[model samples]
Target: MESDSHDALDRRLVHALQLAPRAAFSRLAAVLGVSDQTVARRYGRLRGAGAIRVLGLSDPERLGEVRWQLRVRCSPDSAGAVATALARREDTVWVSLNSGGTEIACSTRTPPDRSDHSLLLQHLPRTPSVLGVSAHCVLHTFFGGAQSLAVKSGALSAGQVAELAAAGPRVAEPDGPVPELDAADRRLLAVLAVDGRAPLAELAAACGKSESTVRRRLEELAASGVLYYDLDVDWRIFGLRTHTWLWLNVVPSELAAAGAALAGHPEVAYACATTGPSNLHAVVITRSVRELYAYLTTRVAALPGVQHLETAPTIRIVKGPGPLPLSSPRDI
Candidate 1:
């Protein structure tokens, strides 16, 4: 019973951050109806346990960058090394070992001038241990970005959520050309990529800027959709233990419908339209394999215009949604 209560509080706290990533502890406490110290203590415990974390991420799409999803089929002995190499790159955002660790799936972002195929197609396949490689360019994101799977877990009361949502800056739409980053901007992003809620003084010191300058730049980056926070919460805490990535092939004419349908499914964490034979990709969470089976047979089968579907169970996640801290002019 105590465990359940603790997990509930953790979920609420995570959801609160999703609503307002930079909210003060006192604000969170007011929305949660708890003391400020209690809220801070809970956050400390969760962070210490590595059960949840907040990371600032740059939105590649908003920056007019290309994001590609690559699947690598490698010999069992070489999969780990290949996955580690991919994760070490500053471009790769998420890396996962799937299908019992023989297959690796990762997402990488590149600037407009950089060809997306070179890394996965020209490089990876030449290696003897790699059997096959497929790179799918992400075309449309049905869900993800500002959407939080933890929020979909519905851990907070509607009133509380409304109050929390009102506490943060409203997300502004990206406009005009992608903003060019100066040296200080790059340094700021590098540090915030690791910890979104870093103190202003610390950020100022790292970026070699005044606190007010750092504050203004941070707001501009966030408002422009160049940066935002992602709360990496353990889905197990929300009673969703199983994770599966689904690839769907749909008729080109019905692609929008299929993507929209999957986005509305509660089991789906994120869904995107992509290039290749499988035009749609979705990540979903469930309580058990049995529940996953039911979703595949019933809910997934019911989606309109889905021509073919393939599911890969995520065995392990090596890197998460946030990009690793990056350095160097080219990497940033």
Candidate 2:
């Protein structure tokens, strides 16, 4: 089918982008063995469809920020509205409806004022339809970063990845706190947050700096681990039809070992320690329900510290990593 072929090309393009977030069309074309125009045209089409986006994101770890996973149970009638309102907050990074549409789950970063707990303790419980709220601080991240969900389609060949790495900015995630950026750096990051692949001239204009200066500063920020790129794509398009979040109750003594073990599984996009009934949470992608079944039975059930587990299917992705999804007339 024509649709099938188009979908195939789109998946390949997405995979290539994940390997090299800011690679040039020529580089991608050569790696994919297609013409440069074809690569650019396919990328434009995918962007127009809202199926993929490349964002220059600040690494939360490098910024000394904590990520918290929040789960809200609301009345069926008010679930959508409550999720939408939460998605609008600047601190919330990802939002989705899960578990048959009655529950909302999201990831939020701690703001400068450290008001993350207020969301669960004070705000949502006060809502008329919210039934329950839980906040789980992400104490550790095992398998999240640029390579998180990018594994669905398989990573590029080592040689191809090496080639792309040689051609662009190298990343170095800092272990200790990196100094905060200046005003000029902030302006540059603001623009890139919108469009990571923006042209150098355009970035310079936005920041009121010369191209050479902009390039140097961008490299410095990346080298210092202040900024990183996230390659977002609709996993369904790549034949990964099942997405689920797993919440695990692990023994306190083995929490770290359990989290580390979950992170090693290829199907797991990310695994982290939390602060609630489910002390561990992971995002997983699979090709089908059957595949997910096999993973749970053979792989997950066998983990040492996992005493109990719950799985919630992600029904709708209301907001993603880059920006909030805008509500259109159709939403009403």
| Model 1: lDDT to the true structure | 0.83
Candidate 1 collision pairs: none
Candidate 2 residue-wise lDDT, 1-332, digit = tens? 12243555677677777767778999998987789999999999777766677888877777777788989999998999998898888778668888988999999887555754677678889999999987888887877766656644554666666676676567675564476778878788877777788899988998899999998888878778888877766665666767799999999999988888888887898788888889989998888889999999988998878889999988777777765745321110
Backbone N/Cα/C clashes per model: 0, 0
Model 1 alpha-carbon drift over 4 Å, by segment: 1-5, 174-177, 324-332
The alpha-carbon RMSD values of the candidates against the true structure, listed in the order shown, are 4.2, 2.8
TM-score of 1: 0.93
lDDT of 2: 0.78
Candidate 1 local lDDT, 1-332, one digit each (tens) = 12344666788888999988888999999888889999999998877665667887788888788999999999999998898888888888668888888999989888888864568667787999999998899999998877868768789999988988787656767564557888898899888788888889989999999999998988888778888788766676677778888999998989999889888888998899999999999998898899999999998998888889999998777777776423211100
* lDDT for position 17 in model 1: 92
Candidate 1, position 243, lDDT: 85
- Candidate 2: Cα lDDT at 68: 83
Candidate 2 total steric clashes: 0
Error of 1 at 100 (Å): 1.6
